[model samples]
Target: MLRRSWHHVTRAASGIRWYVHELMGDTAYAKYVARHETLHPGVEPLTERAFWRQRTDEAERAPVARCC
Candidate 1:
């Protein structure tokens, strides 16, 4: 038996792995799904300073950090 057949887009990004569809840090999917985007444990595009700002604005994000 399945819990819920929820569908999500997934792929390996620059840093972490197994990111949720809404938290994907890629812009290619941003414009359309931006409204539904959410933050998850995965990569972020820090190639430029502005990229970080735009990403934060897009997702209202805060990185998931570990204590160790």
Candidate 2:
């Protein structure tokens, strides 16, 4: 019973961690790489630093209004 309870707790924690990472876009680069490989196997995917720099540049070019 104790072992099962611990397993449940760990699983739930993992799920929460995944959710948080996805929500915060922390997994964007990983997802991008997977899709890029599937869709364009021959092309090299952008480096993580370059990917984020491009993202930031695009965002700056078209600023979105947010109520914060």
In order, candidate lDDTs are: 0.46, 0.96
lDDT of 1 by residue, 1-68 (tens): 14332222222242235344336655444442443344423545344456566766867566667798
Colliding pairs, model 2: none
Give the alpha carbon lDDT tens digit for every residue of 1-68 in model 2. 99999999999999999999999999999999999999999999999999999988988999688999
Model 2 Cα displacement at 10 (Å)?
0.7
Instruction: Give the C-alpha lDDT of model 2.
Output: 0.96
Query: Of the candidates shown, which would achieve the greatest lDDT relative to the real structure?
Result: 2
For model 2, the superposed segments whose C-alpha errors exceed 4 Å read 66-68
